[model samples]
Target: MGSVGTRFPTPAVSITKHPATLPRSPIDDDIDKERVAAAVLPQLLDLTAADLTDNAIWRDSLALTGTFRTFFSRELVANTWRHLCKKSTIQELSITAGSAQILRFGPEACWLQASFSFRTQGTFPSVCSGTLGLVPHGYSWKIWLITTILEQPLGFPDVDKLEPGPADTDHPGCLDCIVIGAGLAGLDLAGRLKSMGLSYMVLEKSVEVGDVWSKNRYDSVKMHTSRDYNQLPGLPKTFTKEDYPYYLGSEDLARGFKSYVKTFGINVTTSTRVDAATYDAASKTWTISAEREGTALQMSARHLVLATGSMGTRPVTPSYMNHGKYQGHAMHSICWKNAKPWKGKRGVVIGSANSAHDIIADMVSEGFTSVTLVQRSKTWVLPASTFGALVDPVFNPDTPSEVSDRILLGNPLPIQRLIAMEGIRACADKIPEYFERLEAQGFKTERYGDLWGILCDREGGHFFDVGSGELIAEGKVKVKSNALPLAYTESGLSFEDGTELDADVIVFATGYKGDMKENAKRILGEEVGENLEEFWQCDQEGEIRGAWRDTGHPALWYTGHGYAHARYYSRFLAMRIKADVEGRPIPQWSGSC
Candidate 1:
């Protein structure tokens, strides 16, 4: 696929790049031929009409809230989206046990809504639990520079969605600033900056917004924090018919962001691909470049926000081959947008991480004859049921001011910290069964970070608190199957012990490695003035505040970190950048670049 920018004299890594990509016909408006169809929610659940009624109760994750008009706008947008995809087939991205198998590409009024209830992996946060649904528009406008045919019609190995960013010197696409990956973080940053009258653009590598939700189609995906605590600053809100808030489905989330981007008229070049970038310290500008629809071009931007969050891609095949290959429909959850490919395929999901676990559970619900998650090692697996419908009374958002006077609402950092600590401690005393069952299942544990973490988690596991330390030793989540994955032949997998099992598909849920390209590294280099990779040694956490390095450059800011409060975190980083540009002092997370 063709991408923007100039070629460096000599690049550090040989990035396998794609050239100009293919394009699709703009969807024609046929309101007469097409109309928003009434939605028949997925049949995965035998829900009574009562189940369909709103039940978004319990406290929020973040303290932020939005106007009903905003969220209702999205619902209306979904209505319009329903009009768009009346004939589009609906598929379930994921379907976990005791929860709904989310329907993807469902008909609504203006958009197609993918609705379901998902739980975060391993995270036992008291605040960010519960089930919800969402409706995201279909095919707004995409100028794809990258595409994969592996799962075409439904998905590609990678369909690089183009997004527009800051104005450029010659190429009109580049502008003052460009934010990539318009998920929770990108939209938040873009909207906030636009509100401040900044001339900027957002470049999403997907065909749409909500890449975080779009990318990981695995079942049981949800925020690790409470919904209230994890909203984008300027979006609308839909309260539970009762009172509290909760996590919305992937499509619902995409709708929330789509509204933010559209309502603000954020300049986004969806489906455009950025090839390479070079920093001109002389100009204090980045010579950004990209390719779209078979054309090559370059542009200049004062700043670049690499809000592409943590964990870029999940592989369909494991990095290491245990033996020869056998194939039925082996693919990663990232590549599986619909169930058509795996409808009746028997599957073996390698690795026991959140993605793998979620995929297996979803496939089973989709009527995949049989699914087994091949464990290289067991982990601190916290089922969704534990956190599903969980209600924590300690989080200050729901606490009345009179009772929370000593803890929340503009309290000093010390008081807030004390309350945070006290509430977590109480949770620790209250919830142990979540972990008790895991240990009993023989899933050895590693104290997440340390002892304090155990108490902080109120329970134990990976996604709970979002940080890793040796602090909580309540038996850290352990990987018991450190042994290699066995080999798969024509019909099955064979282990060294001669243990063999039949298989139709073999999926490697082995997570993603950090991959920031030339432009990203060049930005990193300015900090050391020379060695970029060397600097990574000092900062093992990789990108700070997602991708914002502590370099003196303010133009280089990254927001999406794919952690608990990813949407909020991106907003936080963007807020800081907004402050920096407006001559306000920027807060320091870690001064060392």
Candidate 2:
């Protein structure tokens, strides 16, 4: 791989950094708020079917809808909108009945929430509801993000309602491939394999297909990326900008996965957990032992795909923290479902990553007595709204999703890091005050080399700021950085700084061992786990070490992390697996042969 800043072909334009300009006047007043709300409907309608090339509303201001995980640029938004419109006819769009509420009334920017119901052309007619994010601009407001969800699935198929039991465990059968964890990556690989007419069975430990999303029923546990970037392969856009426009919540995302399985007739074995796998190089096959409802079953397959995504398995809690001594409740953020019991109770959340910040914010919003965030180290913070504007625009909707994915992923890791670093700088320069206020609150924020360095190069080290930054900045959520919990006291947590904080509940958002090393040991035995090179970490060539590529183990593959990654890379994985099964000579992958 080349060094950082190596010239590479990217769709991104010139980089510019400047703080977000605020309109001289305020727009949160009663009259202005109402005025902005009234004006927003027409502007939103204009973006749906009409030409947005010179639309007056978004011409001066960008519409940052949840087209993707982050902000979708005005141009990409236009392209996506046009494409969706071309596919479906607008049956109905109703905004008059919906109510608008102010989310934030900050001097720098105001966030507003509003909902609208619409029906468009599809095999199904569903009433979709969307939450709009608007910012004050002069006397009016500019719409930034719209998070849409299917409110009523009128025409959408209810696959879960259909009668289908778990995988047939009575019979032990051998197949070509066995995919573990029916998440985005597993489903994607299964879809690709099915298209190739390959025989396979997806084993999901959970009861549902997208159990990661289904089981994690947190209040605001939505995907970090945009819908466009997180799509499954070979599916008619079930979640295009025109229909499901918002960042997907747990239920909706699960529903999408269930729908995909039904649509593709993808063979999946739910409620089945693989206990162990042993490979036979002589036969080039793996014998798997799995349990479903306490029944031990054995099966065999030529290829084993570890699709149990980066964060799917266990939550990492600091073994140092004396949980036994603490009288309060303690849990990982992944298990957080509702904030009901801890409504008026004081809470201490460990770590300052995305889940930590989200849990803190949710607690604060739920009227917790006080929620303090414990930051063990400095984290790179980027406004989630800037994602589309700075990073996602490079992935234009006009380009095929597969092509765009290849272009982005095929680049040298250092170049990607440089691009991410450039975006982070541009964002910081664009909203210096956002960082200024965060710094004022005793939070030390800095980009760690670049965003990709944290996202791709490393396991995890950043928080995508949505609204949590404000909570921390305004002192709504307390922070304790560079502090480790030495021990837990009866009342609260005692840190290394010799300070104690009273807490009713302690939530550890401390993250997990995403490399699935422990999982490898548990599933593939100690010897296999020990021999399997570390997965997810970037190699010297800036490529992922053992995932989606070669892991040196015969007929074994690992993949998980992002949706676009699964959507595009599944093809390559499928091709390799198919080639091996077809007795084709396997060529060298990636490096110079």
Candidate 3:
């Protein structure tokens, strides 16, 4: 019932059916590995325009969907297939070479990992190689996962191919791993590597572990993620009655990380900053130069782990036309120590993101006479309690942290985004009061596309109302949405809208220059760092493109993010490092890869 050139469409009901019409004669029949590979691999190779519409040819879904994801469900798979069928077209696709390797076999299921090279018509027609995952179904196995190494689908390259350790001879006293940063990501990864019996040391630029949390923090600052989901691997975050049951204070979270250091006895070299790292291709070792207390030091390591986070390392303050002329107090949110000194003074906080709002709240609490928040763009604000009620059911304290992390992360990124959008739609009408307050206070509010899109896609531009939104709603904190500051006067600031506000202190909650490549260049030099990719941005597949994976740069690994990201991915990173150190191939289809 289709046109001459159009491919035949399988019945909608049969879309989920197995290729085989009949069940196998023996329920326990061993899967013929060669037969399944022969049947499925060819389908992957042949890409005709008509085959694009054939439901039986391609998988219903891929394992990765978003900028940061690891798993997918059957329903998501089907939906993703439909989405791709519309967005993509295949002019030509030919398999150059392919081989399937059986990774594991049991009575009911067999795990398959395949490597293939192919040529395509469009884009760059170059050799493409990757690993594909298969599982046995009716008479033959079916394709469930496909990961490419040549051009990573949105997020990152194959875990197995990631170059974690150097290839050359291991010189005497060369440390197995050299981890940069001493915060959560660095500490967590270092601990895992040590447990694997790898000689490792952590370099902390700050004087102590969790320096970001414990030092130079504003009053009443705490983690946005709940404590249960924020705990490090072995140690749980400790909280007091004054703290929110779901969230941990910054100081408390820092203390937990500090405690983890003590319990694990992680080797941390404090006050050490990596000034430069040169990778010697011949020796396959990294000669690193660092400074500790103004004393230059040298260290050599087989592997280098970049745990530097995505948050701006350097604070960004607005460069007002008269910034140099005005004498009012000015500082970025990161440098905010205490607002007590500015008590009884009028303040203007530029930007209305999380940090901006938090700082506004702090200024108010510290007895500022008046505080006006200048928002350059619309922001998505959700009440903290409501946020907890919606997501806490899955990320609550009662369930084991590991269980919650695994189940939540198992779904493909697109599916997770869809579910989040649905949840937001369901709750939209019910949360009128939350929005009404903001609108009543002359604040413009907008819902971010998809539920978690703002958090997943960009670094900033959203606020989860802990208490600031309520204050803004109640008119306790003034708001000036969609306003741009033109210049700074002796008293306050002049806006592009011909409006001026008088203020004693100006706090720019703007943002940091979140370029990981620049950070890489600063530490590794141009020759080496130029080859690295940008970190923390979402790739086409909806997953984060770089970080924590095999970036084309060898012997250099990147890892970061919140508690959950650090906790779950540190293990995978450690496994990759271990495999590289031992000169063993990452076993096929293993979750570690």
Candidate 4:
């Protein structure tokens, strides 16, 4: 079924058959589907739909249903919320996506909700709602974020015995701040707001925490930025080993978030998403709405924060013949579940970034017949450990072998120089597209945008890190580039160079389009995001503080909004956003400020 196609009768159900019952089936059977569906649906926890548009309510009920998500979960939001006159009584509070009707909840409970929908698969649609549940236990307080996905039979979202509060915003209780995207920046901002004793809510869009890390499971998804610099403030790692750098893997980082959540008692809604935000100047608030799983919900808050961060959704995929027709498994590095499935089978990996390099190495090391890497371009690779083979030297007796050996290995100067050259070569592998585009658009030329571009602009130097490219091209590892892939077939992969190799799996490592444009559109309007020349000019001038809209929309802020570079940008972004919190003076360095 498509957006609208095959329609299963109300309360969809399946009938079990009894063997040798053809005669019985021939007779007319008047059955009550309602009763049967009711009995069967509840027994099953999973409520799946091929396409929700196939339902009658999809068109009309979709929006209304989304608005109803406020009943799914509750969260103990932390931010700058207060009234001017006296010490804020409700200092550091929580907001729950109380039951759909706010009046049903108690006065102490703050009602809030958000519901969202996504295509789990081409044929499957998913919908879920998140609610901030409110409950009281002695003098202490706790808010729970709950979510319920829509079922085929539409079982009502579980409601608490105590009545939830109604959606009434005209009272003394009102949000002073709202922040979206529960990533690094959001968490930091939330912590700051909490410290400042302001009421604020942070919204995130995934089933779990750690926005980028949780969404991307690529094999080589390690932090490229130096761990010494990357650690979030307050999340310090002082002990060091003999190794030059310590690796911070996913598990390590996830643990840090859990600890932070507990230590700060930060309220967060896992498996939730913020879909829409409407700024109401008249009320000095933003009508924030979202979808948790598939249900709907809304909230009101002042001083909106769009911390959706960078790297939006998945990268754009190119059209290829038999992309879906291929019999073998095909997936993006972002969706690489595990190397287990591709084991013992030939794999054709694609891409040139760290992910492609890491995944190909992983696949080959496993039991695959061969792992052929199909890269889009050449790239730099930085190894965590020592790189390549080592050499040993011996000397004459008169010269004392020890003496010759010391001469060869003694001075760290020679080894360091060699390492430096190798590192420079690695840095040279970056794509020249940026330089070419710069030239086309009129930038200082003769020197490319690789290392030289960094010299030109200190602020943008992080984009081109030296020494990463040489390791991959030094021939110490397996790889293929200089030629692009032509097409994917049932047997294997065919590159544009007439090279073909049998492959059992194909993974596209294609990169993501640095698109803050859509976000800019929301911040500004269609004219900025759609009109090309206008966009370029606007961005050239308007993006005063890296990604700000250079001109209009003074009070808003978008943290970590530029292209991929050193992760330091995130910390810098946090500092910038910290300045924007209401009542804080404008940041001195910011052009707008």
Winner by lDDT between candidate 4 and candidate 2: 2
Scored by CA lDDT, what does every candidate get? Answer: 0.40, 0.64, 0.61, 0.38
Alpha-carbon shift of residue 126 in model 2 (angstroms): 42
Model 1 compared with the native: what TM-score?
0.54
How would you order the candidates by TM-score, starting with the best?
Answer: 3, 2, 1, 4
**Candidate 1 residues 1-593, lDDT tens each?**
11222321122221111111112222334331112211323321222222221211111111111000111122322332233122222233232233322221112112122212222211111111122332222522111110000111111111112133332224344355777667666766766566545567777667776655745565355454455444454423322213433555566566656655655566677776777666676665777667767677566766777766534442435643444466555566566565446677776667655555445555665777766555665354333333332323422245422222111222212222233333334444445664564445444443222222222221222434221111112323222243455566667676656666666776676665444333455434443323332111111111121233332343565454432334333333444444444454332212110
In model 4, the Cα lDDT at residue 287 comes to: 69
Evaluated against the true structure, the overall lDDT of model 1 is 0.40
TM-score of each: 0.54, 0.68, 0.71, 0.51
> Compared with the true structure, what per-residue lDDT tens digits does model 4 show for residues 297-387?
7777655666665444446566676565567877776678557777788776666555565566667557677665554533333233212
Which residue pairs come into collision in candidate 3? 60-77, 61-77, 66-542, 66-543, 67-542, 67-543, 67-544, 68-543, 68-544
Candidate 4: what lDDT?
A: 0.38
Please report how far candidate 3 places residue 168 from its true position, in Å: 26
Give the number of the best model, judged by lDDT: 2
- Higher-TM-score candidate among 1 and 2? 2
Candidate 2 lDDT, 1-593, residue by residue in tens: 00112221112211122111222223444644444565675665456423222211111001111111121344555555544444444456555443676643123334554655566555333455454446655544666554443333343232112222232334336788999889888988888777665678999988877767877557767766667777677636445666564567787788889978887678898999898898876777788999998999888998899988775456788865666787888888777886788899998988887788778878988899888888888778877767777646545444456545644553334433554555556556767787889888878787433566566645566787767889989999888886778888888888888889899988888777665656777887676566665566554334455667655576777878788766766766775676567776233312110
lDDT tens readout by residue for model 3, 94-198: 332435555421122235545544432232222334445565555455555544332222122222221122322332578888998888888778766765667
| Model 4 alpha-carbon drift over 4 Å, by segment | 1-172, 211-216, 235-245, 293-296, 322-325, 381-477, 519-551, 561-593
